[model samples]
Target: MREVAFIKQNKEKWLEFEQAIFGNLKKNPDDLASLYIHLVNDLSYAQTYYPKSKTVVYLNHLASQTYQKIYKTKREDTNKLIYFFKTEVPLLVYQYRRYVLYAFLIFGILTAIGVISARNDDTFVRLILGDSYVNMSLENIKDGNPVAVYKSGSNWGSFVGITFNNLRVGALSYFFGIFLGFGTFYILIINCIKIGTFQYLFYKENVFWESVRGIWIHGSMEIFAMVIEAAAGFALGASILFPNTFSRLNSFKIGFKNTFKIFLSTMPFTLMAGFLEGFITRYSIDMPHFLSVFIILSTLSAISYYYLIYPFKVHKKINLKNT
Candidate 1:
């Protein structure tokens, strides 16, 4: 329908809602909630069909007010955590998948910069990955054991330390979203550049395939989860930066809840990555080529399906249920 016709259709109900809130047309909390849900359904339709219409803005404002009223008197769902993972997080991922895509793009571009810079300037590798790591890799390469660094530590020790560090990085990536998301961007810059330079260092030594054989044993999940965490950070920052019709504080609460759920969702992947790094990666060179590829592909596929494919499926299911 045209925007004008759409508004005309809902304008009377809109005025009724305004009066309900402003003129104190008393209603039970559950009734207010029922109204809120129906309003959101309308708002969702407006967003999909008449996104640029002022009707969407008006509906969003009205829905948010209803939300606030309902929430103030709402009872907590005891299965909230389970519900969050099964429904809420998937919906949020579908909603903010663009942020995730942006994270991947940022990572790719910065990594490409690192690779190009390292290829052009010998010092670029040292600058990005640091002299100590670059020198160590070079020494290991000269020793014909380019990825020996993966074997330097004990499995359990590496597992604990690596997992701990990855969690810290993940938390920082998500928390930094508070700084208008530059925090996550900066984190991505550092890591992606380092990855590019480090990979190029192997490439320079002509151990590119050999390096890939080892690094990807765990790097697939490790890297993918980090990128996802960065996306969560961006989503968090975006909530604060663009509150839409909601109050800034309310938007932040929504953003914080959403980002935290997304961030928490990555924990299993991060721990699995650490496990692969600790127990599995050390043997990457000795493992059969097929086995290495299997581990990498399986991890990559699992994360890819969950993040990329599963959300769309969940969205369709939700849509079907709502319909």
Candidate 2:
């Protein structure tokens, strides 16, 4: 094909590849493989048919820059991973923290409302929780057990099912962010409401503490994973809303890429939450109160440390090195 015709025929693909390589450069500046491939292609095409053209000059410049970048591949990889942990993850944590604060605040305010309404009208719990769940819990409470629900499912079956279900929910929450952020917010709102109402139902039975100890053992990880998923959603949405220096399409592409990483990070947490809910929660009633409290606090601390504190520390270290 003639040079112009070749350029015309493959222009779209070239542009797409250019954008992809450019985006990766911002995140992984020393990704030599991509840089090399892109540079070689552009250089070969330009040198072959556009020897005296301005495009040839541009291609040479880009190729030289890519070669320099390739030399720092090791440094770049390390910096990128550090940057992701520190800068990227922490920002996500901050967003998640905001969402959590909002979720809890809304939950607390609604619980107060539920309590007030329940006091004024005995049937309020029924309206919120439905009569069946309330009745079953009441019976369990009377029998000196406030959290019999955890024991209802078969152990092995519950573990597999709950784990699969929670992972699916987390994945969906992340995936739905493709619609921007509304889909993620919707997931957070629904779960917050369910948790609040569920807590209120137990509060009605005067077993709120018991319920919290039993439920939050697993709920901490599950809910936190959900929040991370929401952050992923926000990431996806932000790409569309604020591309910053990048084009909107480029932004969306990057956002989805980061969100996918975040989703992958939450898998182990989902499994842990499922294990706690399916197996550990049932035994909480049988275990000593102090032991249960310790387990809950320790898990919370670990989650907070890894997702919150660790990222910040990593970020600071990276920033210092970069500076």
- CA RMSD of each candidate after superposition: 4.4, 10.9
- Shift of residue 234 alpha carbon in model 2, Å: 1.7
Compared with the true structure, what per-residue lDDT tens digits does model 2 show for residues 1-323?
57677667756654544554454425354455565566567667778887887567545434433433443444444576555554555544443344435444544554466556666776666776788988898898888778888898888888999899898878777787777777776666556655666777778778899988898899888877777776666667767887754589876875676567667777778899999888899888888999889988888887777776775575455335433
Q: Specify the highest-TM-score model's number.
A: 1
Q: Which stretches of candidate 1 lie over 4 Å from their true place?
A: 1-37, 40-82
How good is model 1 by TM-score? 0.84
Q: What is the C-alpha lDDT of each candidate?
A: 0.84, 0.68
My TM-score estimates for the predictions, one after another, are 0.84, 0.69
Clashing pairs in 1: none
65-149: candidate 1 lDDT, tens digit per residue: 5654564456466376666566566767877899999999999999999999999997888777788988898898888878899
